[model samples]
Target: MLVSTRLGAARQIADEAALALRPEHPEYFSAIPPPDPKALRSDVGGDLSQLFLLLALVCLFIGAVGIANTTLVSVMERTAEIELGRALGARGLHITVQFLAESTLLGLLGGLVGTSLGMVGVVVVCAVQKWTPVLATRAEFVAASSPCRNW
Candidate 1:
């Protein structure tokens, strides 16, 4: 369980030591084993990260499509209101801006709720583990300004 920045040099040194000791004690020499110098770091973490990244991307795509579909349906359902606004001098650009603003508002609200919940979860886990909560500057600020303690 030696941690080395240079595995090649470390393994070679261990092997040389083992070989040196082998002639005097052939019976115990078999116990000395050297790890493969060419063996790479395990890919399990990288594989898991890539898997989660792909999953998040897929979920994001689906969420975006859902948002778009819901907004489209809302606009369609409110066609009469839109037409009324137009008759009352609301320009086409105004209508477009309205929907854009609505979508942006929805996104912001989602961000706020999601972040809050995530922060609370982090705080809870930290508390349960008797560990300090580590957060980015923005989150630190949020926690500092809020009623939450022990973060």
Candidate 2:
């Protein structure tokens, strides 16, 4: 596999460097060669991943706030209906459970719809560009596939 090959090369390089460093002129022979151009790229990838995580967290927080606001508004608008239900024997806990279930369903539906839309967009872009989709070329995939790239 590509991973084993990369790891083997890295190990060979490290062993050579170790030998080189033990020579009389240690300064001339560094412990390791300069950073690999390909390997150095992963630092940028790590930064991008961190940025994506931060953005995703922010979006999730905003979505939660929006959902909370909507729930509050719904509760206010249906106060009379809720009161009628309560009078008909529905307890406060039952009402709370009903609202939570409704919210959960709404969230699930929205997620499914969004995911479908995203996939469609990706397909459209690839079609327009006449390019094959590389669904598994993400940073994690590449890192796992190439051992020498591991930090």
lDDT of 2 by residue, 52-148 (tens): 7787678678878878888899999999999999999999999999999988887767666755565566657777777654443452222222212
Candidate 2, residue 41: lDDT: 82
Every candidate's lDDT = 0.69, 0.66
Best by lDDT: 1
Q: How far does residue 88 in candidate 1 sit from its true spot (Å)?
A: 1.5
Tens digit per residue, CA lDDT, model 1, 32-52: 345453343346546666787
What does candidate 1 score on TM? 0.61
Model 2 TM-score is 0.64
Candidate 2 structure lDDT: 0.66
Q: Whose TM-score is greatest here? A: 2
Using Cα atoms with residue i matched to residue i, what is each candidate's TM-score against the true structure? 0.61, 0.64
11: Cα error in model 1, Å:
2.8
